[model samples]
Target: MDGRLRVVIAEDAAIMREGLTQTLTRRGLDVVAAVADAQALRLAVEEHRPDVAIIDVRMPPSHTDEGMRAAREIHRDLPGVAVLVFSQYIETRSATELFAEQAGGVGYLLKDRVADVGEFVEAVSRVARGGTVLDPEVVRHLLGAARRADALSTLTPREREVLALIAQGHSNAAIAELLTITPGVVEKHVAAIFAKLGLAPSTGVNRRVVAALRYLGS
Candidate 1:
């Protein structure tokens, strides 16, 4: 994953698609192909085998779940290719379904993120490098809707914030930087979150992913 990576975009809105293409190109990424529908997306990915694919949550014919289905297929068939599910609003079901049984090299971002070219590009790159990038709003919504809300009610506000950041795949250092707190304090919050949530100590499982699953009621 060196040099400018090849990208494939599948978005129905012409203006939005073109804008994305221009932005990625301007940022030194090569837009190998930009298509409008799920079929075209599959074809483009199969033909180009790009490093990353930016896909919408809906498109063309049915305009419902087509993009999501295509994204899942790409993730299955092209393990090396990173997929970013870009949408206007948070769809909890879609987000959970996309991450089901897998957590690496994936991202779910709101379209508003496109306004900040730096952040958007960094997200894409992070996904390309086998890292996860979840939208903060998505995390918030899931946290707010956690099953057995009482289970999460014990966490302090600051501890809850740390849990959400962990779910977003941010390291303690990154979380500290964003929250302007010392890394040691972040670790303390993380410990408090795990304890409050009653998550048993484990070595094989990712506690962050577990926290997210709890939020999503899984």
Candidate 2:
């Protein structure tokens, strides 16, 4: 694998599609294929085997969750290829569905919040390298949902804070830095949160993502 990250874009709008391609290309990412529909996006993924796929929520045929469903299929089938769902709407259900089973290499970001191109590119890179990324707004929505209130109530305030950071795709080190705590303490809190959430210890899975899924009640 070369140093340059490879990408595929699935957007129904031509202008947005081409603009993303140009923007990522200018930032040194390899835009292997940019298509406008789910089928085309799948074909591009199969052909290019890019490092990451940037997908929009609404696309062709139904203009609803076509892109969301496609993103799930790609992640389930091709675990190596990361997926970053870039959408204009903050669909909490869609976000939960995308990250339900997967651990790393998955992300959901609202299109309107992408004000900085550099940060957006960094998100793409992060997902490509097998990391999770979620919009803070999405995190807040999930955290505030009443359905998960009973389960979440078991967590201490600090543990809840740690869980929020985890859902936001922050590493223990990053969370520690943000909260002004030590990484060792962050690890302890993470372990405790997983336990309280009843997420059994397992291998070949991202506990952080599972914890987030539990947080989202997905």
Candidate 3:
């Protein structure tokens, strides 16, 4: 706690960008960079390389998918950086596409989460360390969609527990410790969960688990 968490704020609105910068800096966190568009946002990340990046889902000329696009690039270029996306609308498609590679160092939450500074800061710190934090609202929608497809029923009792943990974005070791099981058993259960969900094997850092998340999300 002696040192501050380095951070960047990217939002299309000047006021919002300023507010975020001021808020975090007042919290003893460093506002290393702040940008108003995706392009600047990208450069700031590579140049300043903050511990966490808070970006608005809508930004720039298009103001549609720019934020999400920037987020993907940040993951590709700086896999260690945590990108927390704030969206006014819950875009399930954006959430699903992110799953194509599987969420890593990412948090997709509604913009409202930032209103509660304590909770918002906690999320930022969590994601910066490779943890995934999804908005509860997003989780509810994903779980609901999956239920309609009967995906939840595919899990065994144990598998279901594992799936819940996956949705919570816990690592295999953490899940094992939480459940008092061996890491190997957690791995096996995760693999089984992915297969049951009909998602192909993953290609990213947290692939299989992320694939399983697409189902748990339902």
Off by over 4 Å in 1: 144-218
lDDT string for model 3 (1-218, tens) is: 34788998888888878888887788778998888899999999989888889888788798788888888778767877788887776766666566446576788888765568988878888888778888989888766665645866777999988877777888899999999999999999987877676666556556555555565545
Per-candidate TM vs. native?
A: 0.65, 0.66, 0.63
- Overall lDDT per candidate, in order of appearance: 0.85, 0.89, 0.79
lDDT of 1 by residue, 118-213 (tens): 989999999988889988887776555554467777778898788777877889999999999999999888888877777778989887788866
Q: How many backbone clashes does candidate 1 have?
A: 0
lDDT of 2 at 169: 92
Model 2 CA lDDT for position 209 = 92
Question: Which is better, 1 or 2, measured by lDDT?
Answer: 2
Worst 10 residues of 2 by lDDT: 142-151
The best candidate by TM-score is 2
| True-structure lDDT of candidate 2 | 0.89
Off by over 4 Å in 2: 145-218
Write the residue-wise lDDT of candidate 2 on 1-218 in tens digits: 77799999999998999999999999999999999999999999999999999999889998988999899999999999999999887666666767887979999899888899999999999999999998998888765553455667889999999999999899999999999999999999999998777677788888889788777654
